[model samples]
Target: MVAKGKVGILTTNYYNPDGNRIIYGGAERYGLELTKLLLELEYEVAWWQVGTGWQKEMLPGVPLYSIPETGDNFQTCPRLNQSFYEQAVQVDFAIYFVTFLAYPQVLEKSISISHGIFWDYPSFDAVIPTEELRRERLRRLWLAFNGPRKIVSVDTATIQWATTTWPGLWHKFEYIPNFVDLNLFSPSEQERKDGKIRVLFPRRLTSVRGINEAARAAEILTKKYDNLEFHFVGRAHDDNLEKEMVRWSAKHPNIYYYWKAPQDMPHVYQNVDIVLIPSKSTEGTSLSCLEAMAAGCAVITSYVGGLPNLIIDDYNGLLIRPTAANLTAAIEELAFNHDLRKRLGQKAREVAANFGLEKWKRSWAKVIGEVFK
Candidate 1:
């Protein structure tokens, strides 16, 4: 079927079209995937995001409008851009995957999609750029969301947050879970080398991702078991986070780091016996968990935003508080119990099958089609 029309995806995360996967956040993954789906459905897709950093050999027919960089050199956090407004009006449908960047023109035409808001974070006091700057940026985001034509949240946790926090705009909110590619991340029977089991921390090193806690747990667990290996596979976007990881790796020889780029993650996942997501909150769908599950690795994640929707304690995958002791215990439990890992991993692949790409594509096609019709 022909698509409704041109669809513009607005966000702040840089999209490396030549890269295998989107880095760090759920919003980036959603934006990249949505653009691909729209194009597959024959829609004229235009991707707008801050930063001209990426090499621009985007998908065949898609046009990537790299908005001029405006924020602090250290941060690519959203700010109003005149070009965003000009390009948005040209699209038939607009979707803001990273909703904070939306301005009046973009918001008025856009379906604002949010995983959660700044208030969802336990405390931004520790995250970089003065607390004052963080607060001001959030202030702009607060006013932007109020003007969106419609709202789409990735999980029930966010839907509830919207209804309770902004009751007046509750009528505009809807829930649609994020999608994962089961074909690419499918289960593969693994080969354990030297009886070593791998645990993965796939998220970028950041305060919100609770990297300190996760790195600490790896240290404790590695000291206890000689056969365990841990991989930290994300770019340390912050200097502080990179320093912390460096310190942890120095102390824990078992911890290895890998740069984020296009690579065969399915094979990497097949080798991984477990995937750990320790983000405190502010998760849209925790794409790492879904991808790990789809690849048949047992997952242990925090009970933060939208996690409970994906993992049930000790059923499909494990759940825990984003604490060092709790993560250590969960890690120890799965590390020793080979049978439990096999069972949960199998069930996880089943759960992942539900969020396949085709389903998400059809859903967007229907939703966007109806809105424009």
Candidate 2:
């Protein structure tokens, strides 16, 4: 097939700019799938992201470039976007992997993505310390919103937030939830030989992801229940955080901490009996939650951001406020009730079928076709 046209994509970071290690996270996975979709649609693709001005290959032929521009107090990098816009002049279209990256100026044929609201937490107060700073940030975001032809929001909470913040811009958004590869994350047919109830926390070691709550719950529940085991299966932002988790896990019985590549996650998901997505804030319809549901694991997640979109309390999965006590109780209840576990897992898999990879591709293709044509 003849290539349609070249598309330049800009992001914050696809990988560590100084090294070859790829950042394994939900947003990175979304970017990968989006790039693959563009490739499947016969568009030549190149990527730009914040780094030490190095160049690498994202795939076989797709080039990934880096820019040295740094963000300011608002975390908006206009210089990076401007750099991308200027350097990608030969490209026919553009994609802002992050919404804020399109600020100040953007190409005519471009769109942006919103992973969800990142400013919902209390610590964001330090980022925008004054009213003037807050207003300036809003002004930049407003300009960013106007720059993109359409903003693809991964969850409804983002669209809701945008509309509430700036009421007249409802026409600028498209709702497309995150997706999962059902074939890869399917349930195990065989029963567990060890007869242990395993619970998985498949998220980064961050406070917003409720890692603290999860850790507290793990410490409490593992000590209380002999048959229960807790697994923490994701990386932290720094080596210190990783070391802390490793040391903490080492000190506790029935608690384990390890990280796995995105491709290797299917086996890990399939082996687990339960999944916890205890996000306190700043989330979308998470890939981990969807993959867990697809793997037929009974999921317990917090009612924050887009998590509620995936789970219904006592229906497909358990949705609750993210607290150490609440998580411990949920795990305890699931551990004691085998029938509830089986039912929730079965329903979760059934609900997860609606967000399959093919459907996601078709939805994205429609939007891309309309914008790029």
Model number with the top TM-score: 2
User: What C-alpha RMSD separates each model from the true structure?
Assistant: 4.4, 1.2
lDDT of each: 0.73, 0.91
Off by over 4 Å in 2: none
**Cα lDDT tens digits for candidate 2, 111-195:** 9999988889988898799999999999999999989899999899989988999998789998999999988989999878797
Writing each residue's lDDT as its tens digit, candidate 1 over 1-373 gives 6666777777665554323334455565666677777776677877776655343535677766666665632122444345666757777877776555554345344677776544467454555448777766545655656666767777788778656766676777766777788878887764576788889998878767878888888888898899899998777766576776667676777888775553467777877899998888677677788899898889999888888888888888898888889988998899999999999999999988888878877877666665544
How many residue pairs clash in model 2? 0
Query: Model 2 misses residue 298 by how many Å?
Result: 0.7
lDDT of 1: 0.73
Candidate 1 regions with alpha-carbon error over 4 angstroms: 1-4, 15-25, 52-57, 69-83, 125-143, 190-193, 238-252, 260-263
Per-structure clash totals for the candidates: 1, 0
Q: Top lDDT: which candidate number?
A: 2
